[model samples]
Target chain A: MARLLLLACQATANTVENEQKSMQVAAVDTSKVSTDAFLKNRLEIVRVDKKELPDGLLKVQVTARNVRTGFWTQLASWFMGDNPYQIAYRFTWLDIDGMEVETAASTWIPKTVIPGDTVRLNAVSPNPRCKDFTLSIRENDAARG
Target chain B: MNTKIISLIGITSTALLLTACGPSVKRIDATGNEGLVTVDEVDFKDWQIAAEKGINSLLASGVLNRSDGRKSILMISTVKNSTMQHINTRILTDKIRQALLRSGKVLTTTAVGGNGPDDMASKQVRRLEEDDMFNQSTVQKRGTAIAPDMSFSGEIVQQTSSQGRMRESYFFFHMALTDLATGLAVWEDNVEIAKQGKKPLMGW
Candidate 1:
């Protein structure tokens, strides 16, 4: 009985560790826009565009393309190339001093897109002090929150 | 009681007890994917999504940046809720206000607005000029308060339809920023959210 309990505890710990790793790996920064998402292997970041508007706010537009796989790899019988993934993204604004500039709209925004399609996420600096930004992308779980 | 009635009562009590032993409450990221969602209601995540979309549109419109090279003064106006749900409109406006403030392109007037002063202290402090307890030199002058260059207003509308056992809802967030002097909308945008779920047999 004691040995069984130890094994169960180890299994629980492993599950927790896997969850943490998945969440951490899910976030892909714009600086590493070339890298694909570890959270969902199908989603790939194709292009990243950054510019300053007339009002001196930094705007970053990230384009992500979804790559599709077979039914066996997806683990589903239905495979018509229309499978959609709910993805969430958040933007963090950093000032000249490298401090985060918090805005009320700094919450994650969720979007649903099908594989073989592209998702464009755009965000502007909430403050003029924010000269730099970091974008985090992850899979959105609607009912989990 | 009949056997059917007795079984019904026993099942109801057991269900209630099970519900009472539901999961414990815990804090989660408000903007993340873990928020509660209802097919017919405007959830917190919905408001967040709408507010961010509205802010992005407003900023990208370039209406806040005037040709005079000065920050525009803005007044917060009423946002009519035409939806069935009772929504605290501030949850939507406050986010836009905060983002605009951070952008440094617009300053919201607290002394005057469509619904009157946001901060009553603005007027109460100025009223001290009439009082003798304080020096009148430090008091705010009448002409010192600047008028807003633009007015912000919006409406939340919803449309619902049922198809078989599934119910679908579409919420539209329509917002506009008007030029106070020109009396014309300088910028306008709309954000829409569509959700469909299996309809419950009972209450909404």
Candidate 2:
């Protein structure tokens, strides 16, 4: 009986550890982040999908999950105005030759994500020559006030 | 002994006060949200959002494409400011121009504008053709300027309202592309940005 009880306790501890490991895995995928190493820890990019549109423009969609909660409450956020973990993302398009395809559409865009919420961000290349792209994301420091 | 201890405490307090009064400065990324919002005025982020939406929609519409497989010539028209806040309309137009130019589908003409001419130099150089002060051969000849195929113009308007303690402001950026020959609007888009918060201590 003593040995059986000890094994049961160990199984419960192992189950808790596995649950934490899964949560961490769901939080962020390190392999998918091709650029911006700084955001690897701060943000959780769950999925990235790209396709060529009928017009030859390349469309890219990124789904990101926020892993952190608001540091302040609603009333505190309203009064003192805290940065609600806002993110700014920009995409750089590259042609088949690996040269940068400059487009006016490539600008820093700001997005807000509630804690633990998954949000989809999409962008289309301005021209057909853009066959590849690099996405960069960073936390908005100004919003963190 | 007690007086000496009191003096030491006073000096420590003074040092702390001075340190607290020192100037503090921090640098932040311009593209990210620094959490700056004003109830009465439009902000840079607001402009970015508007420009992004307008450019994206314009590109997706393929209105700048020409049937002749040649780059379309574009002219800047009047962008009327109907908002209460003073704003240079170029903040929105320039973004569209830059995007269209980079796409290699459109070229903007400096010889034409709503006010008169985008660059008076194009017209001023013509006078040199008749003047002996300069070489007539090098001067721009008449009918050499390319006419714009399309004209770009827009309007920016704002609306404000309040209910209880919360106030809201909405800015609408409306843009249209008109075909010069047909005198028809080929493409049009509107971007709206709305903000709601408590009433500020100052201007609306």
Q: Pick the candidate with the highest TM-score.
A: 1
Top DockQ hit = 1
Report the C-alpha lDDT of model 2 over A13-103, residue by residue, as the tens digit. 0000001111212322333344343344335777777766655776777778765545554344334232245666777776766677866
The weakest ten consecutive residues by lDDT in model 2 chain A span A11-20
lDDT per residue, candidate 2, B99-200, as tens digits? 777766789987889868868999999888879988877888998889999999999889999897787889888999999999999999998877778855
Grade the docking of candidate 2: acceptable
| Residue B172 in model 1: lDDT | 93
What DockQ do you compute for every candidate structure?
A: 0.57, 0.31
| Clash count for each candidate, listed in order shown | 4, 9
lDDT per residue, candidate 1, A36-104, as tens digits?
323346577676777778777777787777776566645431232225665677887766666778787
> Which ten contiguous residues of candidate 2 chain B have the minimum total lDDT?
B28-37
The fraction of reference interface contacts (C-alpha pairs within 8 A across chains A and B) present in each candidate is: 0.76, 0.48
**What are the root-mean-square deviations of the candidates from the true structure over C-alphas?**
8.7, 10.8
Expressed between 0 and 1, the share of native interface contacts present in candidate 1 is 0.76
Evaluate chain B of model 1: give its TM-score.
0.85
Taking the tens digit of each residue's C-alpha lDDT, what string does model 1 give over B57-166?
Answer: 88877788778788889988988899998888888888888788777888888777666778888778888988999888888877778888888999999999989889
